[model samples]
Target: MSAVIEVVSVINAATGTVFDLERDVDVHAESLAGSRETATTTTGRRQLTLGDEVTFRARHFGLRWRMTSRISAYNRPHHFVDEQTRGPFRALRHEHHFEDLGDGRTRMTDRMTIRAPFGPVGAVTTRIVLAPYLKRLLTKRAVHIKRLAEQVG
Candidate 1:
């Protein structure tokens, strides 16, 4: 079964700043430093663009996990989407939307669709465990991005 997680936050920064911060590889790594998450890009690029791929390795649930994602869609300073090519989930797609709210503010939304491995068991696990864990993780990341954007915007 597939599950979805959506989180929205208003950032006191311009869309361009928030958008760029979202795609900054270094910022992403810093945001998840508590997890010891590290990322390596296939092209060694600091910023991710359409068609770029990045592999992230982290200690989650007390075990090391690795996931590779590709930037499948990109519309600069507006929105972007990344899909997992290899990860714990059977399938994962994340959409990041940045809406210009004038006066140097932006409304940022993150939508994630994930499918677990096992069939029925995965469904139950997703709802009871995985979903909540991911929601918290994503929320933390968003907060990190917002703080950085506000400081540097």
Candidate 2:
């Protein structure tokens, strides 16, 4: 079974600010510092755009991992999606959405779908273990984005 994890944050910032922060490669590396996550893309830009492909190297759960993902969908100041093209997981997709609250505030949401590879065993493992761990990981990242975005301007 594929597991879906969602986290929502309301931030006192413009949609553009929050959206840019959400897609900044530097911010991502900084936010995942505990995991020592580093991201690099062939395009060599700090901001990710549609069709951009990024490779991530990190250690999680005491295991080193490398994953490559592409910005599959993008709409500036609104929403974007990145899906794992190659990774340990059978499948992974993350959607980042920003909704303008019309008062310099934005509602940002992170929706992630994760699937494991080993059929029944993978399903159960994802449901019982990976899902919760990933949820916490995403939550921490979201909180970091909120804090930094709110501080901007």
Candidate 3:
């Protein structure tokens, strides 16, 4: 079974600016500093574009993990999709959407679908634990991006 998590954030910045920050590897690293996350591949330090792949290393749930994901779809300041090629999860897909709310505000939505590795038990644990954890992580990332984008905007 696959667990899905969705998060929405409203930023007081332009959609384009927020979109750029979402694709910036450095900004992402900073936002996830608590996890000591780092980019371990060639595209880790650069802004992600279509077909770009980045490998990330981080400590989560007291365990270190490495995941490599690629930019599967990109539509400029509107939306983008990234899917995991290798990771702890059996499968993972994240979609980010940005909407212009007018008057310098943007609504960002993150939708994720992830399947854990342990079959039924993994699915149960994902629903009880991992899903909420990921939602919080996404929330924190969005808040950080909002602050940064507002400062620049």
lDDT of 3 by residue, 100-129 (tens): 999999999999999999988999999999
Residue pairs clashing in model 1 are: none
Model 1 misplacement above 4 A: none
TM-scores of the candidates in the order shown: 0.98, 0.98, 0.96
Measured with C-alpha atoms, the lDDT of residue 16 in candidate 2 is 98
Better of 1 and 3 by lDDT: 1
Model 2 lDDT per residue over 103-136, tens place: 8999999999999999999999999999999889
lDDT of 3 at 143: 92
- Scored against the true structure, residue 27 in model 2 reaches a CA lDDT of 94
Worst 10 residues of 2 by lDDT: 144-153
- Per residue, candidate 1 scores C-alpha lDDT tens digits across 1-153 of 899999999999989999999998899999999999898899998899999999999998899999999999999999999999999999999999999999999999999999999999999999999999989989999999999999988
Q: Which stretches of candidate 2 lie over 4 Å from their true place?
A: none
Residue 136 CA error for candidate 1 (Å)?
0.5
Q: List, in order, the clash count of every candidate structure.
A: 0, 0, 0
Q: What is the lDDT of residue 122 in candidate 3?
A: 94
